[model samples]
Target: MKKNLLWLVVFCFSISAFGQAPKHTFKLGESDFLLDGKPFQIISGELHYPRVPKEAWRERMKMAKAMGLNTIGTYVFWNLHEPQKGKFDFSGNNNIAEFVKIAQQEGLWVILRPSPYVCAEWEFGGYPYWLQNEKGLVVRSTEKQYLEEYKKYIIEVGKQLAPLQINHGGNIIMVQVENEYGSYAADKNYLDINRKMFIEAGFDGLLYTCDPAADVKDGHLAGLLPAVNGIDNPAKIRKLVNENHDGKGPYFIAEWYPAWFDWWGTAHHTVPAEQYTKKLDSVLAAGISINMYMFHGGTTRDFMNGANYKDISPYEPQTSSYDYDAPLNEAGNATEKFRQFRSVIEKHLPAGQSLPAIPAAKPSMAIAPFKLNEQVALFNMLPQAVKNATPLTFEDLKQDYGYVLYRTTIKGGKQGELQLKQLRDYAIIFINQKRAGILDRRLNQNTLSLTLPEGDVQLDIFVENMGRVNFGKYLLENKKGITEQVTFAGTEVKNWSMYGFPFKNINSYTTKPSAIQGNGPTLQKGTFKINTVADTYLDMTDWGKGVVWVNGHNLGKYWAIGPQQTLYIPKEWLKKGNNDVAVLELLKNDQQILKAIDQPILNTLKKINVE
Candidate 1:
């Protein structure tokens, strides 16, 4: 009997210690979130995986935890995952599941927001560029084509994340359906479809929809929880959630903005940390859950940055640096705001619990000035031209992003007002290999005078797809390059030779040595060495508008037009020895010497002639 009893005690202890792990249940309650039947408050911060390097995800999450945040939020970019239809990339920086796993490892819960149409200033509102080629397709709606494509992508995401939910023994507690849909349109049917898709994709956890406080009624579905964004009044947030959620509770403030994103020509948006601490304190004191929009706004690298356009606001393309002046700066350093917010959060922490120590800032260094003297003209490296009677848009030619050159032979006898009908963004026109003038869509100026010579001249119009609109009704018609026809002297110019410069691989062209001549787009190349690799910023003060690449990695676009004058170079992309550098300068560059500095110059602005 004694031997049997001893085995029984050991067996009971084993069952308590290492038997099947108990499943956690997270659900919305009358006035609070219940975790395993106990009321829980989520203190979350938003950090995008694509924006931050995958190598730095764990460090950023550590920073968030040190700031007293218990949860981490992120938007899984669709375009980043599936740049082309039927092709998916989930490796390296695109490994979102790894990001979530890191958050869980840091003892932080995750709020999975794998919305199909996330408008986080991403390219095309996170819709793959190939969607434009689909006929009669409407995104963020009940269009059959859109729904079919969205289902495939979302289901794939579910396969990766569904098993990680709280009930399945992971830290993911909630999954958001659609991102700010009510701000775009009031399509209840479309929102419903999105909800069903998430459920069918094996997302059996609690689901929610987030929108501006005013548009919650339009975006919120019947069964899911309604989360308010933008506004942060304790009473107002509670009232909005109650009103939309059938007078129930468990209110969530999805996106409480501490600062705003900066556009190319505008001033960097900054919000004083002290200005919002009072509101943040009141919200937490009232026992409401909150998620800061950007605890650390990382870089919007490459050509992935989006633009803003509407009837009231002029066309404004967002800067590549997505440093939203949050608690953690773009380089992931804790700022004064970080200290202020931590003090405020300390006041709300439970007894006997304290925030973790803030992690040390990453190392940074400055490099001596370097020169890019080797030159090659952009026209010398054109791909095989696609002959078309009419000019083709970036989408029509099956080319997404980058520049497209439209060339045609025109009679030189008559010269009048030359106009490009509905030019997508920016264009530089040349006549017989000589520059004529430039037209910018941002200023809504597309007409310029042309002087035709005696004989037939090659008229080339170089158009750049600056960025696609990420929000509002304008996103539906957002296509790159010439969307319509080009006219010289009010006459339609036909029989065009279109050349697409996707620049997916420029190694072949950048190596072909050719002497630079005239004031046309040129490719400049050089090399530099660093003793120790560290995060730095490339100063673009003297260069004209163009894209820059280091060691073959695209560093994104840089223009002389004010606001952003430097490009951030993450340490992960740099090496200790020699590094190859190249720049595709769109305009003329008087001086091609560049320098790497330790700090970012995000506020510097230059005078632009839009006239």
Candidate 2:
């Protein structure tokens, strides 16, 4: 009887211990973060799980925690979760649940910022491209169509994360409403709708909106907490919080800009570690909660890269390497800035807590060059029926991204001005399967004069969708593959064959002997072998502008100028032996040989003066 009583007592204790949720909350004017009504100070860092690969998520989070961050803040990218309008993807790296679960396992609290407009310098500021395709979709505004779509996205996200809130026995403490709404416009309805959507979806946790101090008033939603972002001055933060949130407590630096993003043509950006560390010290001294803009910046990957627009200049596309020069680099390895910030953070901790040791960095291996030998002529691979129809857009054929081929036969020899009417960005023109000339939309030059052959002249044009225009008033004009008319020597060509090659089926292209070549506009194949793995850049200077793929991974576009010259080939993507590489150089001259060099970022190519 005594033994049975003891067993019951033990069972009760175990249940009580395991069933209780970690006590956490945020109350305004509280000098310390509150945990079950007690004061606590949160040292946090922002790193989105979706941005980093799933395999590397935990390691990055662990690194953040080791840097003295008690909280792991992440912005849930709506576009990544739902690429299509209705279709959703929550598996793999899109698994926000697993990411949150892992954070809890690491004994870290989570700050969920499911912004419909994250603007993390991500494509369209994290808004899906398909949203732009929606007629009359005014993003971040109170437009009816935009609101309806935003509400649906919020509801869907809430279904996945609402239950994980602190109130529901999960680690998620605060859920941010719309991101920086006031900075763009004073849309009260838009802000309110987003907040209500969260509540409607059952996210009953502490709700808040983050905005710069100047825009706080316009961004604040009723019945929700208001946090300030991008405030370097602690005194200003206090005043802004007091003015915006009733002069209360529990203030936060929602986004401290530790580093900035770099565009394709611009040189790599770097801010001295001392400046960031000093600002961080001040914030810590004030005992305010803060999250770094990007504790770690990861790759944009594939065609998900975005563009920045300046009214005076042409559209500037962001590079694939989102190495924002943060405390953590794009590869998830800690930077010198990371260490300096870590030391500063450690000094400000409430005296009792200690930081964990940083984990060992991922090791990289050097790899030898691998050659590919198989070549297939793109002109010969066209389907039989495109002969009778006009050239169609990517939408007409149900294709999404990558290179598309347009082919036709001109009876007249090449001697007149060739103009691609409204060429959607870029095109490589070929006559008789030989490189004739190149036209780039960046230069706003779509006309070229080519030497045409008289007998059965075949014309081939390869067009690459080099990232859809991601932002602003001009987004409506982002349709791919010849949106306007195509004129050769002032004559409209009829009956052209269109081939949609999105690069998704890159593996399907059969490998053939390097010598199996054809006539004009023929696809040539070759292979090189590599024995060891190292970070290297494939010099595309010799080849006319085109896309290159190594081991089936699209290495982005390469041109022979002052723009993105060397695509970063991370050691992670390289194999020790026989790695495959294929190039679709549109205007290949006789000197089209690819050379690999050790470097990831490129800036030495000849820059075209856009003036």
Candidate 3:
């Protein structure tokens, strides 16, 4: 009888342990975040799931919990979820549903910001690049086309996540409606329409709009919660919330900047650890809820980097690495800032509620250099030409990114200056597949003179869309793949055959001889071998300008220009056995030898050429 009693007691304890919910809820007016329902203040950390690997999601969440955070906040990138217009991708790293489920499993509540425009320094501010093609399509506005597309995206995202809200037994307590709209423009109609769409999509949870405290009046959604983002002063934050919400409620810092992000030409930015700690302490001491802008900032990866606008002359593009100098760097390892923030948070936690111990850092691999054995010539891979073709944009072909080739044969040797009336960004001109010259739109001139040998001369011009102009007043001017007329000796070249070569299809091309029968710059192919795997950077400082790929992953564009010298190759992508590397160098006739090294920052090519 005593043994039976002991078994019953053991079973009861097990049930109690396993049945407890990971999150607690707090109530405000009518809205609730039920963390045991006792007015729990969430010290949350923000990290994008798509930016970090799926395997590392748990570890990062654990890190946030260990740092005394009760919640994890993430922005759902629309571009990532819907790469094309109507199609949606939620599998692989794009699996945001699974990411939320994992955060719940790790015993943390979630704050979701499903911004169709998440300005997380992502490409096109999370809007798909294809949207640029729709004529007169004004983004974030009340335009019918923009609204139609935006509504579809939000509805699709809602279909995936609406069932997971706290009301439906999920950990998502709050969903944000359109990020920081007031700061950009005073379009209340746009904000209201977005909020109404979210409601229409069945997101029944509490809705909020976050903006700078000053812009709260302009950006805040009427009848919903208004949260302040980037407000360092606690007293002002409290005052603003009370003034806006009518007397009393919880004040939250939606985006607290722990560190800053750096561009290519600029110096690496680092915030003083002491100042950040003191600011964080002030917020916590007030018993206010705060979420760090990036508890851990991960890599942007591939061609996903965005550009920032300058009202002045030079427009600068952001780097591929989204390493925002955050408490945790791009690689997911905790920095000195991480430890300092943890200590401060631990000091402010309620008594007896000790934070979990930090987990040991994950092991990193050392990658070795590898050779690209198989070589396929770019010229040989051209598709059957579109005879007598009209100039077509990327949307016309239903293609997204990468190079396009326009080939045509001329009758006579053209002596007068040739000009591309409207060259989009950058292009390479070749006579009979031989390098003739280059036309760059940054200089705003495509005039070049070349001696063409007579009799059925083959003219091939290769053009690359070096990322559309992402921001500023000039964003409307962004278009790619020969936006203007091509003229030979001031005569318009009408008959042409255009071939679209999106780099994603590189693996499908068969090997062929890379011989230059005619001649400007010859397409050359070579391979280097690697026995072991280690993280290394390919020094592209010596090569003219082109794209490089390792094991099919586009490592981003590299040029001999001043700023970005080496492309970062994470060790996780490399294998111990033979790894393939390919380079499509635009300028030829130079001795090309690429060396790989152990570290990324220091392994740039020795010769730095600016001219």
Candidate 4:
């Protein structure tokens, strides 16, 4: 009881020192944002709660406060909250309400971007994969089934966070309606439905919509404030906001990109601090509100990283590490850009006031290489196969993510081109239990030469859902695995057996590794002891393509196709004793050893299969 009293005392003291009243008002005025009826300039930074672990949310917020930011911006991912239909999870790292309350305790207000359709390079644009099962459901539209699911999700979010709004004695100052709807379509009716949903969910604070500069006019609602994204020109920002927002003057850059995200085959993107700090200074000089798209881009853990595709570009899957080269690195350590931006922001602070002290960098360690002695072949542990006349997609099998195997027998002596119609993503072909080429959707690889033997040969096509396209027009039909038929020698192959490997229970299948062998997917296990635990990167430089699990915590996917060579393992997932490591390598593993390195190799590249 005494501990509770002391904790309350510290919380009240922090709130008082931050000049936060129990109740406050935030609204858009004719020429400025009125906080307590006074002109207020929002100095904010973006940090997604799902990206960072729950244990480290407060430290990341402290980093934001130390960087002279007065506000925190976050996007609530629909998929992360509701992985299944009618079932929701707001606990653990998914606890966005706790995230916002922590921001308040850390002396920062919040700009909640709780749009159902968030395109942050997240899987399926933050839409739950189960939505694909809802036939005739068109996302970002006023479609009945889509809206019904959306309303349920948003109301749950509202129940968790709406009461936390600044008007309700909480810290959320503004809420975004829809995310970049103008870039997708020009339907105000669709956006209005989203607005009504937010309002009905009890989000009565200042409502706004954010879109790119070119799409600002198409996306913003007439009754709500419209915030421009991507552009930082002080004059153009004011001009665009005034033109679209009824000659108003509370100019805000909702997504000021200091750097860009990295795709699988591309080089890591970085923008020099000198390049954007100047623009940041100018934006602040004009007294415009700004939210740095990512003050700290944390790791996109698990299989949740997204992909991108359009009419012009090939299917490009995002790298697992979301270290956006921001002021803070993926581990929440301050970068040189952080210091440079802090210097620029210090000049704009009220006289005699100073930012909080920058926190010390988190400690990281390196572990000696360890061998994965035990192994289990994927084929040896296949679940009961579902038989079908034609190959089925991931959704058809009720599988959300991971790999699926399509097996059948093809007559011999007919060696010709083998093809998979509408291959969702990556696939590995095997004939008579021997590896026979690969097919990658990113490279539009669908056909390969096949040489059948004398007898009827067993055919196996293992397909993996690398990730769903989270942006552009192609996202509408992103059904993973073999979406269509398989043909050999121009004849449709039939009588297939489908096996799903969602890997939900990695331990159930891997508790006792076997002496399995073959050129198929293999689950390998390794163990290492640590004197102390800290943040580290599992070096996958020697491995091929697959996922890694440290103490059963998935570190996301890694491939030899260049760019991302290491998987980040947070210290919170580590302990001070023996830790188990598992790897599910799909292609090849010549060396059965792995390393826990201290540094990241995000920019390294191997031979990329695609042009």
Query: lDDT: which candidate is best?
Result: 4
Residue 57 CA displacement from its true place in model 4, Å: 0.5
Ten residues in sequence with the least summed lDDT for candidate 3:
602-611
Clashes per prediction? Answer: 1, 39, 20, 0
Q: Candidate 3, after superposition: displacement of residue 399 in Å?
A: 1.7
All models, RMSD in angstroms: 4.5, 5.5, 6.6, 5.2
TM-score of each: 0.95, 0.83, 0.83, 0.95
Residue 197 of model 4 has an lDDT of 94
- Write down the RMSD of candidate 4 (Cα, Å): 5.2
Candidate 2: where are CA atoms >4 Å away?
1-23, 30-33, 383-392, 408-422, 449-459, 475-477, 488-496, 516-599, 602-611
lDDT (10s digit) by residue, model 3, range 1-611: 99999998887774453343323443564222335556567788888887776777887888888877888899888878888878899998899989998998988888999968877777667778778767778887899999999988998888778766765567888899988887777788888898899988867777888998779988886677788998878899878777777666578889998787755555556787788898999888877889898887776665676666555644455555566777776666667888899999989988888978777654444333433334445676577655555566665666666777887877765586777776665678887776777776654558888788978888888887665555444545656777777887877887778887776734555554444344333234445555655455676656676667777766666655425566666556677655666676666434346666443341122334322
- The sequence of per-residue lDDT tens digits that candidate 2 reaches over residues 166-260 is 77678988888878877777878777777777888777778888988888998887666778888878888888877776667577888888888
| Residue 224, candidate 1: alpha-carbon lDDT | 88
Q: Which is the leading candidate under TM-score?
A: 4
- Candidate with more favorable, higher lDDT: 1 or 3: 1
Where is model 1 poorest over a 10-residue stretch in terms of lDDT? 14-23
Model 4, poorest ten-residue lDDT window? 13-22
What is the C-alpha local distance difference test score of each model?
0.87, 0.72, 0.72, 0.89
TM-score of 4: 0.95
